[model samples]
Target: MVNFLQRFLVFLNIYSIFADGYSFNNDEHTENIHPFIKIGSKYYFINELLKMNWFESYNYCRSYGGELASVESHEELLALQNYILARKIESRFWFDGNDLAEEGKFVSHTTGRPLIFNKWSQNNPNNVNNEDCLEVNLYNKELLMNDINCNVENIAICKYREPNTHCSGKNSLMNQNEVCILRNLVESFAQVGHRCKSCSQAFMFPTS
Candidate 1:
């Protein structure tokens, strides 16, 4: 069992290294209308020409098999900031963080958890007139986050999670938890020599 698990982990890691530059064949709308730009490990879709309200922005990302970007770390934030600066996009953009569920408790709409990292603008998020959505203020050279009115139109920033394995078709976007579950199931059947055929094919495991 332990050896099987080790092999599974190694296989996923190896596949991920090769999947780094793999171009995903997405929907026609996503391919032509709003293509994602690879930055670091993740892919982001930002439309500077289009502006939408917080709800609209969230739905737009969902429609494209992504979520409103949740800036989880300083490094990720810096990369996004650099991209925006290079493009000279001097406009606010909606991210996944929001306090709409509860006042003063900012959470990521994507993860349903408290924001992991936030560089708030000085003396901001004052909830002035019921501001509930989180947006990055690129107009200000500082590129700080601010809680703003949900109805205010802003550029939509969508992000797809990094691909972890080379699994094709529906299994391609499986999350880590799903992978763990599948791995456990595979390990359970390994000793019996009855491993799942699809799983073996997806991970390139030896069938025999």
Candidate 2:
């Protein structure tokens, strides 16, 4: 009976969250939930500790409601590069660019489109030893892109996709608070066979 009640509460909590027409598709909803830093119009989460291969990095970002960072313009690229330099981080980080579909034709894994902007280092994309993954190197005050082997581990940088603006208007705070309460309720029942892992991940609720 206790288990059934917990499951029912979880369902009700999830239902309440959606009943108001709000969903996790909104990046604003996660602003206070995750450790994303806002830069320009997008939010980014840079993992300086955990290193993963290109494919692993791609999925890691998606698991956090984002995708591997993609450079769509020179200004955006400069902003990101500047951020790295400002932080004095010296690690190569993975981006969404790759030439897996076609050699010498780098495209964004996020959008499946040709990279709109690239600041390649001297003679980059050389495909040296089957290099197909893209990474940004910050060395000697220079930020440049390079293609490397997909299996090479690198820091994962993720950019949150543009969010739905439905919750940007009046009463936004009230709505957000309600969603938070619902998410908490669902998480509270998670250990009771409620299985709110998907919902918790969507909202980035702390697992502990």
Candidate 3:
């Protein structure tokens, strides 16, 4: 049972969604409920974000927080979808889990390869030989169950890696922060040069 305010907000959001060309079949849950929290400008999932297989959803969430869903079961998946739909959100979303690398190597967007629990569709992952990545189609909000080429131009999921984890030695030396500090010191010295008196030495000023 949605409260009056939550229902109202959901209505407003649905209106905006439709105005933006989103066309979704309204599910029974057409209320605005979010399983995530927004702080400052980023959104973090209240529970672990679902790890589905869609570049678009991944990118969308990344713009706000981290990867897509890491849902453990079909029940959880439906629950999430219902949660989003109730919130009046349209369009299919991406999950942050995939096995694009090795066969049976499903990995979480936040974690890495070799997931502890693996979920796959019936006869899924029939990669058909060339696929190496996965993407969830908007029309059908389900896992691709196969691999795709990473180079394909499409929405992408992004996650924040541990800060300074991937940076190398050269990268550290080229720190932009150090450069900025150095630049400020040089500018300060130049600005104060006009206030300094000439040296008392007779040769202070070059003859030239």
Best by TM-score: 1
TM-score of 3: 0.36
- Local lDDT at 6 for model 3: 50
> How many clashing pairs per prediction, in order?
0, 0, 19
Report the Cα lDDT for residue 160, model 1.
Answer: 76
lDDT digits (tens) for residues 92-141 of candidate 3: 33446666566656577566755444345557556655545554332255
The Cα error of candidate 1 at residue 90, in Å, is: 1.5
TM-score per candidate, chains pooled: 0.67, 0.63, 0.36
lDDT of 2 by residue, 1-208 (tens): 3445655677896677675655444434666647678775567999888999999999999998889998777778778888898898888999989898889999988778898889999898799999999999975777789999999999999998654434333444445544554555556555643454334442434335
Report every candidate's CA lDDT. 0.76, 0.78, 0.45
Deviation (Å) of 133 in candidate 3: 3.1
Residues 11-94 of candidate 1: C-alpha lDDT, one tens digit per residue: 667655544423343332234443787665467999889999999999999888788988768888888988888888888999
Candidate 2: list runs displaced more than 4 Å. Answer: 1-33, 164-208
**Which regions of candidate 3 are displaced past 4 Å?**
1-60, 83-93, 116-119, 136-208
Ranking 1 against 2 by lDDT, winner: 2
Q: Scored by Cα lDDT, where does model 2 land?
A: 0.78
Deviation in Å, model 3, residue 192 alpha carbon: 54
RMSD (CA, Å), candidate 2 to true, equals 14.4
